[model samples]
Target: MAFGDIVQGSLQDFVNIDRFDTELCVFIHIPKTAGSSLSTELDRMRPPYHNIHRKYFYGDTVTFSRIEDEIAAVIDSGALADARSCSGHFSWTLAAPIRAARPDARAFTFLRDPVKRVISDYRYSRTPTHPTYKETIERFPTIESYIEAPETQDKMARFLMPGDVRTPHEIDTFISTNYAFVGLLEMYPLSFNILSLLLGHDRMPSEHKRKTENTVDNAVDETPRLRAMIAECNQRDTVLYDIVRHKLLTVRDDWRAMREQSRPAA
Candidate 1:
């Protein structure tokens, strides 16, 4: 199944709250990356004066769905104090719709190591409710086999096209340009701390600070077949991972230096 199928019911009315005071923090949820848990924590930590609504998209359409209409209705109702803080699983295309709908909003997203992400996704897809799981696994002997399969490559290409099939650069550009913060799921604590500092919130709670259990039980190894498949299936993600990884390291180093400088004299 594609990403949009999971959401149920008319989320429109539910998301239309108006009272908002915090900076509009949009969590661009990539699939299977602890989004649900993190969003739950964010809900608890959200300021009383802010209106935060969590939503997930259903299809590729750019126009406002029933959900978007609900958001508009809420804003019109003046329930939010300052602005709306909306977070959910949406494609990069949703950026324009959001900006048009709420001009004062800022966007953020988190990404995982693509190989691990794909594995977790494969496990989650196996659920009976997932529309594409049976078809996907039926074609391959193992998750590794599936990764190496050309058809699997095509499937991933279509699902993660960023903007669409034609705009190959859309996703990267969106990350580099629009997002106020692009978090690394591997270094989640640092990412969360950075997010909190950037958004001017206090630290995230201890319960929310830990990583989620791996959805897949695949063992990590460097077998030749595994290596080859990971090398191929992860080429784009390798580039993305390196860039983001470097950025995280830089941020860490800078933070450490700042802390050292701020230390009281001996």
Candidate 2:
């Protein structure tokens, strides 16, 4: 599918990323993108409160099935009145209820390297730490086998679609329209710096940094062929990631120039 050029979102500028002007803000917490740590930080900083839907990082079969749809019921039941911010793993379409409730609420998300995130997610799922551990161990025994499953395809993009966004082009446009900001997990510190600007809050503490170790041993070898297959499954998410990274590059450059200019000269 064809991809679109990175059209910048409406919430940024040369020196500062504009904070959302509305009272309520929203976060689309995509999985395996350091979203949990970011969610914790977001919950700490929002004005009155930050609403968490399905706080568990992982769940059983039933939770996995209802995780994305549960937020809609809460919003429909008039639970949003006291909510200063909403965050969850809900699908891109499920956010419609929140948007309908607070038309002015701005949204944002953080993206990660598609390939790495898939690998990380697979590794994380294999352990007994999460609710789905038993299920994952029984079904998919290896990274290769995991990628072969339909459930493992383009997850990042899937959370953002179900609206004419099947192609890469639609993915970029959808983000530009739906989100006020996009951060990258690879540049975790810098991304939160942008988030700080967006929320007028202090930078998050370092303790919340994402864990980098791969502790799970699924007992199967991974090769170039396996990685290639994973990449192929996430073509559109790759497009989406690249588009945001490119825009962030521009932001970084502009920010550097502004800082250098402001420095006192000898």
Candidate 3:
């Protein structure tokens, strides 16, 4: 069966944020999916915010062991207890801990077309303005090499489904079950709708603007060969992307319906 077809319930059916004791918002950032823009907007909207990135936790080396302590310190300080929202590369790891401290915290994220996301990520990594530009160029001298690297394979699914999620079905179910919203990078307006719904606001902060990264040309030529190549490299990601796209549409429609229903004698 198709991945989207397998989902038996709507996203709202799985969401239960009203039951939380303390309110927190977590944005699980998947690279190259307009996550940076959303994070910036959320940082602007939500106060007492904590933003975590790989560099802050791991630096040039992996420090998986120290994550718990860092998370604990944030919890102990009661920063998370207050009205706070956090966005980070390590969002998935922080999700459970944040919820533990603040039972009402909601976690959400965005996904993009996997092929486009991979290409954007490669181009971004090579841009001089990017933090990891040196390391990326040193490691991946060419787009072909970058495409073949293990790091580029199903990166979104890998980050979102970090543990024992072995199949596309598991990934779909996990996201639907956990996240308050799964937004689309391409559908910014509708994605904003879902995000605003979760944020308990009618609109996002007016001061926040969409931040574009690595404005380099999109990495691929317009041709069947290039398109097929990118797709072949992202089979798993495509499945997850398709699922999110479908869910995002449903979520948006449902929200609109709710808003319409709640409207009084208009």
Candidate 4:
């Protein structure tokens, strides 16, 4: 067969999965990376084929045991019989169980600059309205303390590729092998466009209509020292973000071209 025929066949298979297959698309949401907004919009943007979608937000309040129970129930009850997509702030650990339930699952996640993401996380955690505000303030009395905390270190790196394997090369390999998409928050509009294509959407969602507007908490003073501390602590995440950025830049034109080619003739 010609290479063009192979490409067309592959595109057809992809569309078939989106249309008829009983598979799940898992979104591994990294915090402060516009995930919540995407999660909200995804529900609205969901095509008719995937009407039974679910979103789960993993956090201090939602423990692994709780997730295991929920997942167990979902699987046991055959809830995944129909097409579904789920977004969550959980680690890659959930991938195994999810796939066990639905073998054809595909995963994707977003990454952001570690320094900025950490700063945004800290400031947001300080808000009185934030559920974890009290805990955050109590645990991290200062930005320095927050930056120095063990939990704040290489968060994206750890979350994206959990287990003993860590180095920059390994994380890159893991993402390449596992994730269908690795979006960068810095280039969210383009990333969203690409995401729409991957999910069989004709167009990207508007940036203005966010499900949840996660603004940077600008009132808090971000001094040079704090920025340096964040940078130093999240070196691994910085590397991962750079990898995602490069992937985005490299694939944009090609993906657009393929989408155009894959479209039906007028």
What are the TM-scores, per candidate, against the unseen true structure?
A: 0.63, 0.81, 0.75, 0.76
Candidate 3: deviation at residue 64, Å? 13
lDDT of 4 by residue, 116-207 (tens): 88887777777754655666777887778888888878878777787665677887777776777777778787677666756666565564
lDDT by residue for model 2 over 140-244, one digit each (tens)?
Answer: 877777888888878888787674586666776777766777889987776776666567654644547466445546443567887688889878779888878
The all-Cα superposition gives candidate 3 an RMSD in Å to the true structure of 5.1
Ten contiguous residues with the weakest lDDT in model 2: 1-10
Global lDDT scores for all candidate models: 0.52, 0.69, 0.67, 0.66
Worst 10 residues of 3 by lDDT: 13-22
Best-performing candidate as measured by TM-score: 2
* Residue 67, model 2, lDDT: 54
Best prediction by lDDT: 2
**TM accuracy, model 4:** 0.76
lDDT of 4: 0.66
Task: Residues 1-266, candidate 1: write the lDDT tens digits.
Answer: 11111122221211122112355655666676657666765665553323233443435521224545545555566654354465654545534455665666666666677677766666665554454445555755477776776544422223333514333255445344555656677888766655655555535435542333433433345466665676677666655555556656655655455446647799
lDDT of 2: 0.69
